[model samples]
Target: MLKKVAIGVDIGGTLTKLGIVDREGNLYAHMDFSTTMHKGFGDYLDELKNQIEGLRSQIDFEHEVMGIGVGAPNANYYRGTIEHAANLLWKGIVPFTDELKTRYDLPIYITNDANAAAIGEMIYGNAADMKDFMVITLGTGLGSGIVSNGQLIYGYDSQAGELGHVKIVDNGRLTGLGIRGGLEAYVSSTGIKRTVFYLLSDMMDDSVLRDYSYNELHGEIITKAAEDGDPIAKAAFEMTGKILGEQLANFTAFSHPEAFFLLGGLAKAGKWIFDPTRKHLEENLLPFYKGKVKLLPSGMMKKNAAVLGAAALVWNHLQE
Candidate 1:
C-alpha cells in the first residue's frame, strides 16, 4: 500500500516551516526558511513550490501527497484568505487558497496558527481525551486557541479565540496591531523583555540584564539570567506570569476549560514562568474553579508541533 501524507505549512513573520506527515503522526522531510527574505508574497510562493518539490525528491519510499494544510497569521478558514495580518508583509486580504490552487491541484486548508495548534493537540497530542482546553502560543506575540465541548470555537466571523488581544490594562504596552493594553503586549516574549526594561527603571537593583540593550534582550537571555538567579530577570517572569495567570482565571470564569497548554519560546522558561502563573491562577480563580484547571506544557513541544498542527487540519477536515 502506498503511504498517504499531508503537506503541512506554517508561515510566520520570520520563518516558514514545511513538513510531510502521515496518518500515524510520523513526520518526514521537514524544512524551514526565512519568510522575510523574500521580496514579495509571489516570490515567496515560488520558493515554497521549489522547496516542496525538493522535499518530495528526498523521500525514497512510495507515497501519495494527499493535500496541503497551512497555518498562518490572520488566516480565515471560511474565506481561505489571510486578511490584514499585522505580522506579515502582505498588507491586504491575500487569497491564500487560490494562490496555492494555482500551484497544486490538491485539497488545501488554512487557519490561524494558534487554531492549528489546538486541532493538532486533539488529533496528535495530549488533548485527545479532553473535551475542553486552550492552547496558548507565546512567541513573538501571544496567540490562543479555545476549544469548548470538543469543538474549536471559530465564532461567527471565524475570528474567535483571540484571547491574546483581550485588554488587560488601560494605557498599557502597545502591540503590533497598535492596540494598547492587549494581554500579549505584556505576556509574550516581547512583553517580558519590556517588563525587564520596566523593572530596570523602577527598581534599582544591580543585575546582569542591565548590561544588554533592548535589541540584545530576548526570552532566552532572560531565561538564562533567571536560571542564574538574576533578580531582575526572575522578577520579569513573576510579573508576566501573574498577569497571564489572572487573565487565565478570567477566561476560566467564562469558558471553564479543563486545561491550558502553554507553547513557544517563553514557555521554555519552565519553572520561572509556570510556577508564578500557576500560583496567580490559583489565587485568582473563583471558589469553584480553584484547583480544577491544569496548566501544562504542550505535548508537541519536542516535535515540529506547529507543522504537525497544520497537517492535522488536513486529517481533521477529511474526517468531517
Candidate 2:
C-alpha cells in the first residue's frame, strides 16, 4: 500500500521540531525552527503556515497530506487547544489545531508532548504490542505519557497523566504538586543538581564541582563524573534512580503497565540510575507485580521521538 505522508509538529517552550512521516512511522524530512514570542498574543500560525508550506515544496509529498499532527506544551488533545503553557509566552488559549486545519485543509492531530511521546512509542518504538505502558521524560522538567488499550489515554480535558507532579515526599518536596518531594524531584536533572548541591554543601570537603556555580552545573557534567566513578556523582544518580523506581511501583498499582520507558537527559545516566531504580521498584512493587514491570530505555531516538510522536498521532487519528 502506498503510505500517506503526514506532517508532524512538536512545539516546545524554546524550539519546535517538524517532520514528514508515514503510517509505518518512517520519517523522511525533518526540520526545526525557533518559537519566538508573538506580539500582543497574536497569530504565530502564519509563521508555521509559511514554514510548513516551504518544507512541503522541498519534500514533495506523494499522497498529499494524510494529516497534520502536533505535540506542544500544555496541549489539550480533546479540545484541540494550547492552554496557558508555562514558559511558552502565550497568555490565552490558542486554537492551534483549528488554525492549522484552515491552512493545510487536512486532518490535524494535536497532543501534549508527553502524550505524543507515548504515541510515538506505540507506532515507532518497543511498546507497539503493549496496550498499557508509560513513557517518562526526564529533562528540564519531567513529563509522561500513558497508554491504555493500545491507545493514548487522553484523559478528561487531556490532562490525564502528569505523573511528574505526583507527590512522593510528605510536605513540600520543592513545589511540584505544591508539596516538596515528588518523582521529578529526583529523576529530573534539575532535581538531581539540587540534591547534589545540598549533598556537596554538607560534605565539608571541596571537590571539582565546587568550582562551578550551581546554575552552571548541568546534567552532563554530573554524568561525566559518574562515568569517571566519582562517588558523589554516582551516589546522586543512584539516589535519583531509587526514587524513580520506587514511584513506578506506586503508579503500577493503578495502571498495571507492562513496561515503563524512560527517556531524556537524566535517563541516560544508565546503570547508575537504572540499577537503583530497578532495585527500589522491586522492593516496593506488589508481590505479583514485582517481576512484571520492566524499566526499559526509550527505543525512540531522542531527537526523533517528539516529531515521530506528533506524526504518529495523525496516523493514529486516521486509523481511528
Candidate 3:
C-alpha cells in the first residue's frame, strides 16, 4: 500500500521552504526556492507548481499525497487567502489556496506562519499533551499562536491572537505597524538590534557593539558579545527578556496557557534570553498564576519547524 503524506510549504519574505512529511512528523524530502524571483503572483504560482511536480517525481516508493498545507505571512485561514502581506511580493488579497487548487485537485490549507507554528507545536512539539499554550516566533518581527482548549484560536475574523502587537510600553519604540510600545518592538530579533543601538546612544559604557555599523549588526553578534561579557550587549538581552517576560505574564492572564514555547532565532540565544524572561515572567504573573506557566524552547529546533507546522495544519484539518 502506498503511504500517505502531506506537502508542507512555509512561505517567508525571502525564501519559501517545502517538505514532504509523513504521519510521524518525519520530513522525507525538502527543498527551498527564492520567493523574490517572480515579478507577479501568477509566475510564482507556476514556479511553485513546477517545483511540487518535480518533488513528486523524485519519490521512489509508492506514496499518496494527501494534501498541501501552506504557512505564509498575513494568511487568513477561513478565507483561504493571503491578505495584505507586507513582506511578500504579492499584494492585496491573493487567493493562495484557490490558486493552488487550479493546478492540483488536492485539499490546501492556509494560515499565518505563527498559527502554523502553534499547530506544529501541538502535533510535534512539547505541547502535544498540553491543552493550552502559546508559540512565539522571534524573527524579524514577533509572531504568536495561541492554542486554547486544544484548538488554535482563530477568533471571529480568523486573525486573532496577535500577541506581538500587544502594547507593552507607553510611547515606546515605533513598530512597522506604526504602533509604539508593541511587544514586537522589544522582543523580536529586530527588536534586540534596535535595543542595542538604543543602548549605545543612551549609555556611556560601550563595548564590542561599537565596532559594527547599524546595518552590519545582528542578534548573533550581540549574543556573542553577551557571552564574552560585554555590558551593553548583556544589558540589551536583559532588557529584551524583561519586556518579553512581562508581556508573557499579561498573555497568561488572557488565555491561562500551560506554557509559552519560544521559537525562531532569538530564542536560540539560550540562557542570555531565557533566563531573564523567565525571571520577569514569574515576577509579573498574578499570584494565582505564578510558578504555574512554563517557558520552553521548541522541540522542532533541530528540524524545519515551519514545514512541520504547515503539514500539521492538514493533519489537524483531517481530524476535524
Candidate 4:
C-alpha cells in the first residue's frame, strides 16, 4: 500500500505556500506564489490550480494524494469560506473550499490560520500527548487556537478562539478591526513596534530605536536593539509582555489550558519577551491556577509550521 499524502495550503497577505505532507508531518515538497499579483479571486484560484498541479507532478507513483487542507486568514471551518479578511486583496465572503472542490474531488478542510496552528501542535508539535493547550500566532496580527480534551474548540460558529480581540486595556491601541484595546494591538510584532514608538515619546531615554522612522521600525530591529541592551527596546518588550501576560491570565480563567505554545515571528524574541510574559501571567492568575499553565515557544518554530499546520487539519479530520 502506498503512503497517503495530503496537500496543505497556507495563504498569507503577501504569499501563498503549499506542500505535500505525509502522516509523520514531513513536507515532501513545497512552493510559493505571490498573492498580490491576483487582485481578483478568480485569477488567484487559477494560479493556485496551476501551482498545485505542478506540485502534484512531483509526487512518486507509490504515493497517493488523499485530501486537501487550507489555512487562511479569517477562514471559517464550518462555512468553508474566507469572510471579510481585511488583509487579503479579495474582499467579502469567499467560498474558498467550494471553489477548490470544483477542481478536485477529495476531502477538503478549511480553517483560520491560528486554529490550523493549534491542530498542527496537536498533530506534529509538543501538544500531541496533552489534552488541553492553546496556540497563539503573533505576526502582524495576533490569532489564537484553543484545544480542550484533545479537541479544537470551534464553538457555535467555528470562530470561538479570537483571543486576540479580547479587550485588555482601556482605550488601548487601535486595531485593524477598528476596535480599541484588542490584545493584538499590544502583543503582536506590530504591537512591539507601536510600543517602541510610544516609549520613545514618553521616556526621555536616548536609544537606537529613536533613530528609525515609524515606517522603518520593525519587531526584528527592536529585538536586536534589546539584545544590544538598548533601554527603549528593552522597555518595549517589557510593556508588550506585560499586556500579553495579563490577557493570557484572563484566558486561563476560561479555558484552563495546560500550556500555551507561542508561535510566529514575535516568539523569536526568546527570553526578552517570554520572561516578562511568564512572570506577569503567573502573577495575574488566580491562586489555584497560578503556576499550573506553562508558556512555551512552539516546537515547530524552526520548521514550516504554517504548512505543517494546514496539513495537520487533514490528518486531524481523518481521525474524526
Question: Which one wins on TM-score?
Answer: 3
Question: Where does candidate 4 stray beyond 4 Å?
Answer: none
**Model 1, 1-320: lDDT tens per residue?**
78899999999889999998987678988999988888887888989999888898888888998899999988998999999988899899999999988999999999998999999988888888998999999988899888898888899989999988999999988887899999998998889999999999999888999999999998899999988899999999999999999999999987899999999889998999999999999999999988899999988788798899999999878876
What CA RMSD would you report for each candidate?
1.6, 1.9, 1.2, 1.4
Weakest lDDT window of 10 consecutive positions for candidate 4 = 56-65
How many clashes would you count in candidate 4? 0
Cα-based TM-score, every candidate: 0.95, 0.94, 0.97, 0.96
> Which lDDT tens digits does candidate 3 get at residues 1-320?
89999999999999999989887798988899999999999899899988887787887778998999999988999999999999998889999999889988999999998999999998888888998999999998899999999999998988997888988879998999999988898889999999999999999996999999989998899999999999999999999999999889989999999999999999989999999999999999999998899999987777899999999998888877
lDDT of 2 at 16: 75
The segments of candidate 1 whose C-alpha lies over 4 angstroms from its true place after superposition are: 34-43
Ranked candidates, highest TM-score first:
3, 4, 1, 2
Which lDDT values do the candidates have, in the order given? 0.91, 0.81, 0.91, 0.90
Better structure of 1 and 4 per TM-score: 4
Clashing pairs in 1: none
CA lDDT, candidate 3, residue 15 = 95
Cα deviation in Å at residue 122, candidate 3?
Answer: 0.7
Better of 1 and 4 by lDDT: 1
